[model samples]
Target: MQRMIEFPTAFWVSQYTIRFAFQEEISAENSRNVRLFRTFLQQALSADLLEVVASYATVTAYVKRKVALQPLREQWYAQQASIEVSVSHTPIQIPLCYDEEFALDMQRVMDYTGLAYEQIKQLHLAKVYRVYVIGFLPGFPYLGELAEALFVPRLAKPRQRVAASSVGIGGAQTGIYPLDSPGGWNIIGKTPLKLFQMQRAQPFLLDVGDCIQFYEITKAEFRQMEVNSY
Candidate 1:
């Protein structure tokens, strides 16, 4: 069965790069539409396609040769109403430790939201977030639509080194740092899971359109899981 897809405004980014623009803002519907379209293009242009990338609201395809706009547009219009793309909706449970040691910016978050630490933690755990787009770092999952009360701005100054698996909230979104890299998202917790384990058959624990839920864990539990991760 084919999915009901909305045709995006297609444009040429370059001679060999074509982009499909969906909605201008980030939302679950837009993400789904973008992913579906990317999947469609991969199959439709298999011979000419080099690579396809999906963001919040756009799909960019790198091709082997220049694809004329008229023919591509005709194909896009013809295929718009029938495109099949499989997407997983099962929520992955991420165990998080929100103890003072790992939550470096918890105080800042508390001050900004005027919510107690317990309230903040509960708010974060209450919602199932969607992986809107993965970027900024390899295997990083930009989960979105965070609980309204838990929303807080990113740090004014990004940290020089944010530990891998550190979970943080920024405005209406939340995400986990997959590697030790500089970041500005307000750090609220840390996860024991290695989000970007290159040694594994599947390098990434999350992907675009995937769902996630966070569960609270004690420091001792976190250490146990951390030791087992290796």
Candidate 2:
């Protein structure tokens, strides 16, 4: 059965701001609950609501200055009790090149995981990753709860700068560096895909609660795609 929590009593602190918090224990086996929670929160959006943010396991909804806290809070509680969200099964596929030229720390990854290059590729490509959050950098997505066997620690010392498009793994999480910046995560591969393009109407390519899948591509293909401006 699905689990849920609710905040029925609203605590008013000021004319504009009120506080309400709920902690619901959800199934962590997959990203379904995360996605459902995000969808449910989005349904709450209206003129009175200002923002809605979802993290790994929690969603926060903010309201506008004119909205009355107590009535809105009560409505929110009722909505939460009745709302049902369908989890999405479709995954967004991303193409990446893991050749030595593009892979910054391939050897280190192989050594640490005690797995062959092919094995590393298999593990990475096999699973569908859920975007837990988008932070640290604009459009930088923190993805996974990688298969336990593939979990690896962050680098002992962070690099002064890592290249943009760098794909890295740290702990149970994996991410792509949207921009060249200082970071401690272990680099595994690089994607030619432009994760964050400022020129695009939507600057961020990925958002919280979305699913991502990475596919291995060749260096030549990567170059060709880049040339074509894909």
Candidate 3:
């Protein structure tokens, strides 16, 4: 079966960098295509390629030399038919505690959305969010397409110090603060898991393309997990 998709438009970003734009919109399909093409380019370029970064709808490649469009297009034509995108990976369950002690902006969210605390919590738990991009801070996973009912705007003034592991919702996206940093997202809960541990073999717990499902935990359980994490 020859699966056909619109080939990405590749353009030069700099003397040594090129960017392949898969699509304009952010969706699961666009991400898969960007990742797939990124993999192909890495293998295709081989020795000439320095690094490749896959984002929501773009793949930026840093290379040793310039690349041609026609050959890459031809290569894509030959390979696209055989390769299939798979989103079969199981969702990683992230334990979230929504206790008032941790949910700093709970009342704000409740007031804006016209929902009670339990409703807000349940709605937040309903969907399995995709890791759309990793930015803002290191290891900060921008999970997205939050349920419309839970969509609340970021704070008018960003917080000076959002604690590490604080889970928050900002507009259409939800994310966690991987470290103590200034942030604007509405804080809904906190996770005990260490998202960024430089000492570990894998420094980041989450990456782009990962699926996350958050489950509620008691404040006591949150404390115990915090203890166990250390």
TM-scores for candidates 1 onward, in order: 0.90, 0.81, 0.92
lDDT of 2 by residue, 48-97 (tens): 56666666655555666555545654655466545544554568989988
What TM-score would candidate 3 get against the native? 0.92
lDDT value for model 2: 0.73
lDDT by residue (tens digit), candidate 1, 1-230? 55545568888898899888987998888887787777778778899999988888889999999876667667876876666325557899999999999999999999999999999999899988888888999998888898888878888888999999999899899999999999999999999999999899998888777889999999999999999984
> How high is the lDDT of residue 57 in model 2?
55
Which residue window of length 10 is worst by lDDT in model 1? 80-89
Q: Each candidate's lDDT (Cα)?
A: 0.87, 0.73, 0.88
In candidate 2, residue 194 scores what lDDT? 78
Clashing pairs in 1: none
Pairing residues by index, what is the TM-score of model 1?
0.90
Which predicted model would earn the best TM-score? 3
lDDT of 3 by residue, 123-227 (tens): 899999888888889999989879999989999999999999999999998999999999999999999998998998999998777888999999999999999
Off by over 4 Å in 1: 1-3, 68-85
